[model samples]
Each structure stands twice: as C-alpha cells, then as structure tokens.
Target: MNNNSQSLTYTQALEHLRAQALSKQSEEEVPLISALGRIVSSDQVAHRNVPVADNSAMDGYAINAEAQSASGQRFPVVGQTFAGHPFDRRLTEGQAIRIFTGAPIPEGCRFVAPQEDCEAEDGFVTVTRAFDEDSNIRRCGEDVRAGDTLVSRGTLLKPQHIGALAADGLATVPVRTPLRVGLLSTGDELVRPGNLLESGQIYDSNTFLLFGLLSSLPVNVTDLGILPDERDVVRERLTALQGTFDVIITSGGAGKGDADIVGQVVGELGNIEFWELAIKPGRPFMFGSINGCNFIGLPGNPVAAVVSFLSFARPFLLARAGAPFTEAEPVLLPAGFAIAGRRPGRREFLRAKRRFDGAGGEFVEKYRHDGSAQISSLTFADGLVVLEETLTDVTKGDPVPFIPFSQVGL
Candidate 1:
C-alpha cells in the first residue's frame, strides 16, 4: 500500500473505497408490517386482484344506467351494500340498490348516483341528476391490474409501499437482510461521558455520533465502544472483529502521527487501499477492507467524521444495501452567506442553518465557530454548504451546492 499521505483527496478516497464495496449478498422473508426500511431483493407481483371486484366509489344508489335513464325512472330500493358485505340482491329495470362507499357494485349496475343526486320517496328512489358511465363506479383492476409488477426489486420499502403491497394482497415480502456494522473508537485521551475525565482528556463522542447515524440507516449497528491507544490491544481487537461485521467503522487513529495505528493495523490485517483525502476537515481518513469486511476510518474531529460520513461513507453504505443511484444525490441549494479564505483544489463543507427569506427566498447562514472539533456546530446546523474544488471565491448571494441534514440521513 502507498504510504504517501499527501497523494489522496476526499473524492479519490471515496471512489477507491466505493469501488471495493459489494452489494448485499443475503436476503430474507419478512412480513409486510415489519418490512419498512428494508430493501426489496426481488420484484413483488400482485397475487390477487386489487379491489378484487368492482366496487362503489360513493354512498349512493347502484343502478343500471339504461334503466335509470328510461321513462318513469323511479327505481325501487331493493337492498343495501356495505363495505364488507356482498350485495346479492338482483336488480330489475328501473330498480336501484342503496350502496355505501367501498361496497361492491351489484350485478347489472352500470352507474352510481351519489345520495345527494337522488330523491328517495317511500321505498323508491328517483334519479334527479344525469348519470355518466363511470360517474361513481370503481371498476375492477382500475388502480392495479392483476399480475402487475407493483413494487420492483431494489426498492426501499416505506410505509406507503407497505400499504400498496397490502393493497396487492401481499402478506410478506422478500428483502435483503440488514447489514451488520461494527463501530470502534480509538484514543487513550478519550473517556466516556458522565465519567470524571483526567486532566487533558476529552469525552468519547464519536462512538455515540456514529451509532446514532447508523441507527437510522438500514443496517444493524454494533457499537464496539472505545479502545485504548495501544497497538497490541487495537490489533487484537481488529483481528477479533474483522470477520464478524459487514463493515468496521473507526474514528481517530487515522492521521499521520506516531500514535496513529489504525492505518498501520488495517494495512497489516487487510489491504489498506487509500488514505488521506483532499477535502477539508476530513483529509486524514482511511478506507479498505479487512477479512472481506469493509473498513472505513474517519477523522477524530466530530465535524470531520460527519462530513466524511455524509459525503462518502453514507452513499457507499446505501449502495451496498441496494439503494438506487438517485437517492445519493445531495440536495443542492443556493448559499445564504459569503464565504472567504477558501483554498482551491479542496472541497469544504460548512455547517449552516437553512431558511427562506421573506417571499420564499432560500438562504443558508453559516454558523459561527465552524470548526472541525466543534460538536455544537453539528447540532445547531440544519444543513451543509458544499464548496467545490474548482472555485475558491464565493459571494454572499452566489449559488453554491448544499446538502440538508434531513437528506443526508441525519
């Protein structure tokens, strides 16, 4: 592996890691109720007829169109049809049957006049409004045809998709099993929150941050907790977890320093493909695979971890889980404030709050103290202002690309 730290940029590192990622290899059957957020592994076809049969679209009378329009168009109300009942009543000419919404349209009925459009007298109803062929008639297979492909493969099932599949009468769907991911943090100077920290020690926040981000994604996250900055211990832990997780994510210990053992361990235990990106706040990153499991080593700084995750790791993970290409496109919006002192040939992501000015104009105000180590900036920011590598100058009103926190799986 190349030990040159200055040769890699964020984009190059991401491309290299993404090239090594393999799509999900396993799948399982899950009930529709529990299928939300899971990726479909096979195309799902409708087993039964949608609507199953012709039904009523409103609470009105079901009558034959020709009979209702005939002379002396007063039809006797023979019976009624509710949502779950079968309307077995046979209709004769000039006879109407009362029907409610979702009730199956009875035999010989070609149109339905809503209750407001008819006048009921005694046991007969008179059609006061003209009837069209499909005024209130919901024909069978109108919304979905039989044996039609309802939801295709590679779709991430949401609540709406579940309902649609249910409408197609599917009780269960085949989906890829959730990928199990392991997270690790390395540093002897880091302590867990709520514990009394020794002098010159800071709290371990990367584990929690990575865990939270991974929890919302369609993967099973296992927090390996914190590991001390000892080479033997770190190497032992990595060796134990190398084959257990689909991917191992670590924070810190990736920079070019004497204590940075993450890159060295990965190189020894597996193939270390890329290191160091050209992106701001996340240049010291490592990506590769260990024992056939993907490995991503992010910067120790909170903002750098988040930025690398959003711009690189998130998309790679999503792709491995069978998400489509369009889902990874970051939402780009106009910059809200001026940005100065940016270096060319490096991409920068700034924390900012996104809002619309009066008259529905979009604006993003860069947060104060946008430092890589500032964890508060991530909490306060609504989105990120993305600066491209080609350009350095940015005016206040210039249109710059951005990614909202919501879009980036935050």
Candidate 2:
C-alpha cells in the first residue's frame, strides 16, 4: 500500500468523499409495497385532495346551521352516511344526518354536531349544546391538496412516506434501481464460521457485518466470500469484477502490512488512493475506482470496519444510489461518566448507550472496553459517543456530541 499521502482528519476525509462524482443508478417503476428504502426518482404529486371532498372528522350528526337550529333545537334524522357511502340527496334545513368518520358531508350541511352533545330518540335528534359552524368537519384539502408533492425526488421512502403516498392514491412509484455491490473479505488468517479454526486463525466476521449493514440500504450485494492474502489472486479476482458492479468493497487487506495486498493489487489494476485518516479504530482505508467500478476498502478489525462503513462507505453508496447525501446530525448530550485522561490527536468514536436518570434527564455511558477487536461492545451500545480530535478529557455532566445507531442505519 502506498503511504506517501498525508493523513486526513475525519472532517476532511468526509468532505473529500462527498466531493467525488457519482453515477446514479437507473430508474424503475415499482409498486408502493416494494418501494420502501428505495430512493424516489421523481417528485410524487397528489392527483386529488386527501379526503377528495369535505368529510366528517368524527362520528357525529351533520347539520346545516341556521337561526332556528340553536341549543335545545330538535331535528328529525334524515339519513345516515357511512365511509365510502354518501347521502343520496342534499340535507334539508332543520334536519340532521348521522355521519361516521371519513364520510363525506352532504352539500347543504355546514357543520357536524358530536353525538355525545346531541340526544337521539324515535328518529329525532335534539341538540343539547350549541357548537360552532363547520365544527367536526374536515375541509377539503385540509391535510393534502391536489398538485401537492407527496414526496420529493431523491427522498428515501420510509413507512410514513409510503403511507402518505398510498393516502394520495399512488399505487406505483418511480424509484432508482438497486445499486449493485460486490463484497469481498481478504486475509489469510480469517476463516468462515462453522469451520474449524487453525492456529493463528479467527472466524471472518467483517463480511457478515458488512452484509447486515448493507442490507438496510437500497443495494443488491453479491458476497464474493473470503480471499487469501495473495497478490496475484487478489488482482485477478478484482480485475474480473471491474465494470460488472457499481461498487466493490473489501475488508482486511487495506492496511500497510506486508500481508495487506488489496491496496497494492488495486493500485496495479486501476487507480487507488490510500487515505490514512486521523480517526481511532479505522485509520487505514482505500478509495478509488477500478475501470468504471468504485472501490472502498475498510479495516479488518470488526469494530473498525463498522465505523469505517458508517462514516465513509455508507454515504458514498447512498449518493451513488441517487439519494441526496446528508450527514446524520450529532445530538448534544451530557456524559454520565468521566474520562480522566486521553490522547488529544485522532478523533474517536466510543461505544456507549444512553441512560435515563429517573429525574427526567438522559446521559451517555461508555463501554468498559475500547479495543477495536472487541465487537461485542457494539452489540451492547445504542450509539457512539464522539470525541473530537482536540478533546483531551471528558468530565461528568459535560456536554458531548453523540450519534445514535438509528440515525446511521444500524
């Protein structure tokens, strides 16, 4: 691996990654049920009003308010309107229609009186209390109007967005095709699970970690499995995948060790840049392109690989998948524990979880261990406590920046 380039700070590395040009995936029309997690290809506009007409917001009696229809006034029940069923004729003066929620109000009706406020007997209803005009009535286009954009282009569809689209009468939507990614893990000392481990060998967990992380995004991943630390084999296999996938990701062979051949092979096959980031856990990473396919190399340590993926690779994939790239906002929270002393250089992400104090306040507490090899720390953590490069120590009750796993797609 080349080591001539200067190490970049965490912020600088992120900016560099964001500046790179990306080729978005092609667009496809998919049903609403299949569009979740997919990036919208175009703005989805509502074809009609949300309710389509003025409707009852509650189960009540629809009435036309007049001088005679006051408190204690009696009116005969004219008809009943259920959901998807409207009264056949317009309501007449001094008469009430039993209306259910979501039922369209009759043309001559001006307001709806709550059933609790009216007494109904022998086909006649009496208003026990006076109500305002247009009360309990949901006006047309109150929630959403025709020509309104239900969802904008490049927005990632979530469950709430799906509900809104369905409410606006959208059965199908245009979304970007899934980004094709070729995932590979390289290291002679790594072996797959369910297999006997030889001396100096450990089970390969980075591939499955990357797989689970990528599954949450809109991408189609092809696991290329593990590769031994052989320069010739690595070069030949990577060369064969060039131009076939939108992106190729590899873990383990990204450092400067003699056994790390992924960076060296990539440099020989195509252009590759080795970026030594000033970040704890994942310092060595490679980013570039092989032929037309993009490449991202992460550290071998399970924790480092996860941090690198969340910090760098995830945003790159999202941009390439046609979604607007935006960093997850860090929340300012109090530290429940204290760090007496620490190095003041590289930015660090500590595994931690939020705790409530019962007095209506929350704070973060770091895990007992900070080693990059301890993958179990992440399992017990709800978020990461971010320590800036200049932060030397943390005192209890001090405000620190935190990034929750949910925000970064755990």
Which candidate achieves the best lDDT against the true structure? 2
Native-structure RMSD, model 1? 3.0
TM-score of structure candidate 1 = 0.89
What clash count does candidate 1 reach?
Answer: 5
lDDT tens digits, residue span 212-288, model 2: 99998899999999988888888789878888899999998787677778988888887788898999889998898
lDDT (C-alpha, whole model) for all candidates: 0.81, 0.88
Model 1: per-residue lDDT, tens digit, 1-410?
54555656656666665666568558889999999988899888887777788999999899875733533477888899899997876676667889999998888887888888888889988887576676788888888887888888888787888998999777889998888899888888989899998998999999988888887667999888888888899889999886798988999987767788877888888877546677887887777778789888889998999888877788778778876533244566667777677679887788988889889988788888768999999888988887778876888888777778888778
Candidate 2: residue pairs that collide: none
- C-alpha TM-score for every candidate: 0.89, 0.95
Q: RMSD per prediction, one decimal? A: 3.0, 1.9
Report residue 142 deviation for candidate 2 (angstroms).
1.0
